[model samples]
Target: MKKLLITGLLALCLLTQNLLSQTAWAEDANDSVPLKTVTLSEWEAVLKSHQGEIVVVDFWATWCISCLERFPHMVTMSERYQSKKVRFISMLLEDPEEPEAIALAHQFLNKQFLNKQLKGKNGLAFDHYSMNENLMKSFEVLDLLGIPAVFIYNKGQLTHRLTGDNPNKQFTDKDIEEAILALLKSS
Candidate 1:
């Protein structure tokens, strides 16, 4: 019984240490990178520049648990469709009024881009973006209650909108992939 207690206590300590290290790593990652801010018009210009191709716009935030939950699948989808004529973009929908929030959003992007689970295994990532009020209004963001929302654009036209955690409804990988495949076939 004493041996068993010792082993369990050791395990608990190791687990606690691991969790602490992970938290520190996250904080470090957030502080190590700098992110830029862009206006709505500039964001639109980016979409316009990518016209004539399939663009997946993912609207997410650093504080959103649901967005974090759904992020890996999106990353996988990005990797899967990378060879096709599809472009994946992650748009952070942070507080447009808070500069600190915007900075945190960029740090979150840095963490994601450097994440071993998302990038190390596949070596795949997408361009990161942050959206302002004008951009959100242009994208009709008010229509939705929560994110992470995904918009599929084809040739500069909004084609599909996928939302996460709407009354317990979340999009699956198959759902997103089907949309991309349909768009590719259409183009």
Candidate 2:
């Protein structure tokens, strides 16, 4: 009986340590790097890094026209509310190794996106960040429905999503601002 209790105690201690270590490991992996969100790889830790804060994640593609149109507002909001509780991230949905496509991506981002919010991975890690077409579809973020297809995550739950490229039709920065404020207050 004495030996059993000792063994159980040791097991419990080990379990607790393991849980703690797992939590720390996750955290370190997420906050390992920081910058304006741009690439899919950058978003690998996004959901993790933005814990306790509001995260608006935009899954876009260079070929996406709607994404281009709405890119400016996203970048502006990211910079404007940067000091606040919200963090905005942009991830490309296309493959990076395709030199021609990537070049086009860069040009589109520079000219149309205006390089505002966050561009990540520097090159491409679309698959690494699980932003592939299938993955996006799994997350319900796929389909050529729109650009700047933004999802607002509050406390880890998707609170709102805007799935369109037409700025004239989708939510504006003002709308985003209001949503973030309200969500943060309620949370």
Candidate 3:
């Protein structure tokens, strides 16, 4: 009985060690993912750089209930439509003055990537931004008056904007997919 108990404990130790190793590796991978910080001028430059491509920008905030609800769907859409012509960017509408908000946004992104919710060939290619009021105004997201807004730009021109009247309304992956398909078909 003593020998059997020892063997079982040894097995458990090995299993625990393996689990720790796996968890460490996942954390390391997530740590390596770069989340960029861009000012309004930098953001405009990025937009200009991708002039010929279809850009989908999601305007969100960590505290926004509607944004949180729609984030998973946006992740899935980014993964599903990974393409050279189509690019996905997430603009976190957090005040740049608040460091806590930026840190929270990074944490949320890390979790999303670690869980494979944001997986694709272009998943890591997704650019993240913490936009100030100026940036928000430049993108016209402030006028929309809500989080979880999505805008599609074709060849540097604003093509479509999806903003909901009610914050409780959740936008589905299919809704974004349909918009992307229509845009692609047009070009």
Among all candidates shown, the one with the greatest TM-score:
3
| Per-residue alpha-carbon lDDT of candidate 3 for residues 24-83, written as tens digits (9 for 90 to 100) | 988776564456677777778879988988899998888888787877677777777775
**What are the candidates' C-alpha RMSDs?**
10.2, 15.1, 7.4
lDDT of 1 at 74: 77
Tens digit of lDDT per residue, candidate 2, span 45-164? 667666676887776666767667666666677666666757666666665345566555545555533332333444221111324334345344334454556778887777877664
Q: What is the TM-score of each predicted model, taking all chains together? A: 0.66, 0.54, 0.71
Indicate the TM-score of model 3.
0.71
Give the local distance difference test score of model 2. Answer: 0.59
- Ordered list by lDDT, greatest first: 3, 1, 2
Give a tens-digit lDDT track for model 1, residues 9-108.
9999999999999999897755453344567778778889889778998878877888877777776787777788588888777768787877767666
Scanning candidate 3 in windows of ten residues, the lowest lDDT window is 116-125
For candidate 1, give the lDDT: 0.73
Worst 10 residues of 2 by lDDT: 123-132
Q: Residue 14 deviation, candidate 1, in Å?
A: 36
TM-score: the better of candidates 2 and 3 = 3
